[model samples]
Target: MVSTNPYNDFLKECQMALQNSIATLHLSIPAISFSLDAPPSPEFGELTSTISFEIGKKIKQQPRSLAKQIVSSIDVKDFPLMSAAKFAGTGYINFYANFAELSKITIDSTLALNDAYGHVQTEKPKNVIVEHTSANPISPINIGKARNPILGDALARILAARGHAVFRHFYIDDVGRQTAVVAYGYKKLGRPSLKEKPDHEIGLIYTLTSCIIEIIRLKLALEKQRNVSTEIKQKLQMQLEDWSSIAAELKGKHPRLFTELLEKISEDKDTENLINKLNQAYEAGEEEAKGLVREVCQLSLDGIKETLTNAEIFFDSWDWESEFTWNSDVTKTLKALKKTGYAFQEGPVLEFDADKVAEDYKLKHMLGIKDDHEIPSLTLTRADGTTLYTTRDIPYSLWKFRKADKVINVVGMEQKLPQQQLKLALWALGYANHAKNLTHFAHNLVTLPGYKMSSRRGRYITFDEVMKEAVKRAREEVEKRSPQLSKEEKERISRIVGIGALKYALIEVDPTKRVVFTWDRVINFERNSAPYIQYSYARSRSILRRVKETPKKFDYSLLTKPLEHDIIWELARYPEVFIISAENFKPNTIADHANLLADKFNSFYTAFPVIKAKPEALSEARLGLVKAVSIVLRNSLSLLGIIAPEKM
Candidate 1:
């Protein structure tokens, strides 16, 4: 009836035996905190502990001699799931599990828990907020920017499974200059109805408008430099070349849109000033600016929502950045910092002395800053009195802390400095606890081969486009494998397989590592991909369906092969894996565990004949093992926000 992890349970037994032996020997040593590690290879043993060396050092005895004495004194037969405990190497104590008994415990617990097989609930749960994927509303999310939402959603799933109340938030950045320019383009074009995806249209308009504006700015600078020094003229000429190249590329991509926008933007002498005014007005909540920018942002968000929903990603709340500025949160936060002497005025602009605050509070070590490091002061506002993005984010961070115990900002690695500054700003306002609890879960980028993505030039693949291609590729594979399936069934399977492949590929790699994404890697059925795992699950289910009979009881002793033992060991470690992934905010751990379990299960399938064994008792037990494997695989995939189809 115990729901505790079997692997941890076994470790506890080992630790208790060691503790008792130390007491009987009267060994004088400080309380030891040590860990047990799996041997490098199965030849060593299932679990190995090096506590003997530490204890021997303290007692002034040789490690091997101490290990021998401990082994002779301890009774290996006393352990429930361990068959033998012996000394190896210098002082390592290797413990081998009694696979017969271990298999029974693993299979029974998995079947009993079913969908809740690996998750462990905490006694003290917390309310957590995870903010991610707040991509600008100017364009659809491209593959390069897809990692943020995928990682965030996976983290949220793991936390909820661990019994935390989680809230997923997306901060809509509609008050930025990029959005203001996009809005200007939309308004200049008479706010025409989108003939294609709303975001795609917005992206086209943004690129055309940007290209034209650059050409105009460069021309004016070149005209002014005609009588200047040769050095200055060369610099201006280089700038013009860069803008001209971009203009050429933009024109080639969208000829008609570029020509129309060029004519319109060229005729307007104050286009640059107008965009700047719109940005400032939006921040100040002017009715005209608010109506125009919000309308453009809303249209783009409609397209974004469609793509995310297709990927099965949803948010609990959509927070607007402008709301914080409009609701006086930014104003109040600045005033509080000024009172604490952290805020000061540099000319007409406001700034925060982050380095001084860290020195005064003795927070260098806690903030991960070296003693010789010099932190720069952060600019809070422009000379025109408009607050910066990070300044607004400070108020938003405080708002999140009001409803949650911890806040995780899943931002890109390039924003490390800004994220750190935000935390320090919180500490400056005397919210040290909040600052300490704030985590910047930074992730690297994703790239495709031979292709570079640039939103400014409107040269990027949207998430919707990627999903469509994946599904089309998956459907072809599914049809080739299961030609007899109905059209409806094939479609269903293809959708699950396609989306699963995309999600798994994004998450299977470490977040700190860059992913060179390729369809071959994502859709591979051989190893380490979602399809491989899904197919393994389906094979298990296929076995169950063929048997056509359930065993009232199973014999664990029948499952004693090496491959079987490997599967049982991997299954027993699921709870530990789940707990570690949640604690570290790394969903790749879950992905790794799933792929490993599937590999072991597939090996077991090839090595043994289940449902066709000579002895009925062995066949029934193997069937029970397959059922457990299927349950654990499904549970593991769910943690990564993937579906395990029975007919992939």
Candidate 2:
């Protein structure tokens, strides 16, 4: 079970040949570590090294002349992986791969590796914990929050494929003000039997609780300020009127449920105080508060789980945020931070001195913040003794470090400051190594074309609805193009295409850029999409099916076309591409490579004949090439958690 990367083999040979050439020519240079990378274009050769450009200045000669001199000293016969070495364009040393040997070995290795084609093992595999998709359990997951799980899932898959022991974690943020509000409304409604989707039902309660309480409070204030200024009276009246409109809208949608909650909430003497009690009790681990909140949280979680499972996303562990507080881990971490003299009290609030810690450790530059910029102190606990989410995360982070060597938190970019402060907290608590190993895998936002998402307004689209729309649109596309397929097959293919389309839409773009989720781009069959790549893979499969056994007298050297060479080089580079994707925490790199390879394969298939070529040996070689493309495409897609369907 030897894993072979033909691209690396060629790269190494090129590097060795360059090193030997430098030695053979009696050049006096410093000891150098040799490496080669892909040139800007395929015509430049399979790989390029700029050593001559580096040393030409040192040795006082023109770069092109130095490169030409070095090329003549190397004998290609010694390094069979490389066919030729030459000076290309003003100083660059380029190496041409022997595709005749590369194609044979690349295709043969691909066929042998099969499912494990692109996994290149590292010398030091780590226990990596990826915590992601920690969406609040007060409601169903929305489209705005969908990107986290998809990117997180793809990252875990890539890391695991690359031979790391990867664990996926979902942090259930159950102990929070939002959950307390929803639980309060649910309790007042007698915790009625949920008829609608559990999360949607809970969400209605949350919205109702929020609006009704606001309206009630505003009215009470207006009543008390009867003799106040006209401006103050008008301000209170306007807020009351706004909540009234929102309540009316909710009442129109679910009259019975809204009426029930509104009646019970209006009956309560101090509803806001009750919610505060619930929040504090839950954070304190009171049994009554725990039962009520956990019940509502579990119901919401069940609905969320269904949505994620639809997208084929799952987690290895569901870590409870409250568990840290209950087990006194948060208290322990606070004590440890206090010993470092960075903890101080401001009135009733306790805060961590993140700025002082950064200055003390000289970490402003390493943490990527300017020395002139002040790192804001973090609030550890509120006046009411309830810890903040980031405070709870401190102990949870400690828990994760106990299990793994590295931890990657896939969170939104908006939490950048909080993440930085958490890292400094680790250093303050004497876990500086863990702080160094922690990564904030921050991603940009996802925006719809003409829509804005606001969770508090209850106007956000759910992930479940978007997934259904995608599947429906895919079915139409599948029916229009592949009418010959049976109904069941069409349904299955539609799901595969739709799901893969959504995943690729979120994943193909660089994480630093916002994803513009548009239908035309997502379901595009022409280019740069999952369906296009998937179809190209299917075309290869169909071609292979049309051919019989490969002729024993095949000549891989017949694949001499530019497009053929491109696909061959691409097939050989899958392992290198895979390793890059895994190490850099960028699954988009794999998506980009797969799309490029598919485009090349499609172009080659259109211009060249595979099954009906004149020579039997050439046709056999072409079929072998098609098979190699299929394997690599499927393997790359798998690393992104995409299914490569064999048919349209």
lDDT of 2 by residue, 1-648 (tens): 234788888888887888888988877488554778779987788888888877887888899998998899989999977888989899888899998888888878887787888788878899999999998988888877888999999999999988889999999999878889999998998888898888877877788787788787798889899987789899998878877887788789879877888788889898878988999999999999999999999999999888889999989999999899999999999888888999999999999999999999999999999999999999999898888999999999999999999999999998999999999999999899999999999998677777666555566778888888888988999999999999999998899888888889889989988877666665555689888889998898888777666543448898888899999889899999998888899999999999999999889988999888868778888888888899999988888878999887
User: Can you tell me which runs of candidate 1 are displaced by over 4 Å?
Assistant: 224-226, 230-236, 448-452
- On TM-score, the candidate that comes out on top is 1
Candidate 1 on 131-152: residue-level lDDT in tens? 9899888889998898888899
The global Cα lDDT (0 to 1) of model 2 is: 0.87
What is the C-alpha local distance difference test score of candidate 1?
0.86
Indicate the residue-level lDDT of 215 in model 1: 70
TM-score of each: 0.97, 0.94
Lowest lDDT block of 10, candidate 1: 517-526
TM-score, candidate number 1: 0.97
The number of the candidate with the highest lDDT is 2
Give per-model CA RMSD: 1.7, 2.5
